[model samples]
Target: MRVAILAVQGAFIEHRKKLESLGAECIELRKKEDLEQPFDGLILPGGESTVQGKLLRELEMYDSLKEKIESGMPVLATCAGLILLAEHLSNDEHVYFGTLPVTVRRNAYGRQLGSFHTDAEVKGIGEVPMTFIRAPYIETADEQVQVLAHVDDRIVAVQYGAQIGLSFHPELDADSRIHEKFLGLIADCIKNNNCRKN
Candidate 1:
């Protein structure tokens, strides 16, 4: 399977390494033309949500990428990527894609010093390593959203349809379970003919 990593800004290279290690052909999406490439799934890596959002629009990649996500493209969104997908931001006014039906609080865990790591139960995945840096936890989710994992009683992970949004940076961890789960989602979408083609 082939996957597209939003490389406009963020820790996208880490995601590429993880997915490529899983035997998936990976492409970096740094420009609007990159969207023309055929891919089974998309990965939005951890980074500054504001900067990424701005770059997406400036590069004219915002609408196309958002349309893909809304149209059932399997997406694995980490950290700021999760923020981009959220429908509501409790602490911030700007909303990016707003494809995931959940509310998130930007930098809910404080600043860089607040960043930490741990192993937690990620629903179907079981205990997996999670690293958070200026993470944003889910404040509330729509009824259809599946609660996946939590840390310190805060909602840190959730799934809605083909989209999986996480507050922690699974790419930073050695464990490949999360990325594997994302790839599995892509496979399922392809099998069901729900995944979009180029």
Candidate 2:
């Protein structure tokens, strides 16, 4: 299975390594053309939301990405990546990738000092440690979005259909279960699509 990590900026390198450890072909997305369909799945890594927004505008992947998600492509977004995927971002125009049905509060956990580690019982991964660095706190999620993990009574990880978003950095942890779970979902979707084609 081929997996692409949006490497415009952020912890994509770590995600690539983690996914590679799972025996998947990992690709680091560097240009708009990299967003094309047929890749098994995509990963939007943690980074500064505003910066990513500017990059998306420059690269011209914003609309294409929207279309991909709408077509049921499986994705996993982390940190500011989560903020971008949110439908109602608190930052207005700064919000670029509004693909998921939710609002996001950027830097809700504060600055770098807010960077801390905590443990949460992820539904598929069990109790895994999460590293939150200036993470966006989820304000609301659609009914279809399943709350996966929480931090201090706030939703930190959520899953809506084939997409998953996290308010913390799963790549920072030693655990690869989260990425494995996402890859599993991607594989299942690809298999179903192939069956339909046949």
Candidate that would win on TM-score? 1
Model 2, range 77-150, lDDT digits (tens) per residue?
99978988898877565556677888888788776558888888987678998898877888888898899988
> What are the per-model C-alpha RMSD values against the true structure?
1.0, 2.5
Question: Could you tell me every candidate's TM-score relative to the true structure?
Answer: 0.98, 0.92
lDDT of 1 at 190: 93
Q: In candidate 2, which residue ranges exceed 4 Å CA deviation?
A: 91-93, 111-113, 194-198
Best candidate, lDDT: 1
For residue 21, model 2's alpha carbon misses the true position, in angstroms, by: 0.5
Number of colliding residue pairs in each model: 0, 0
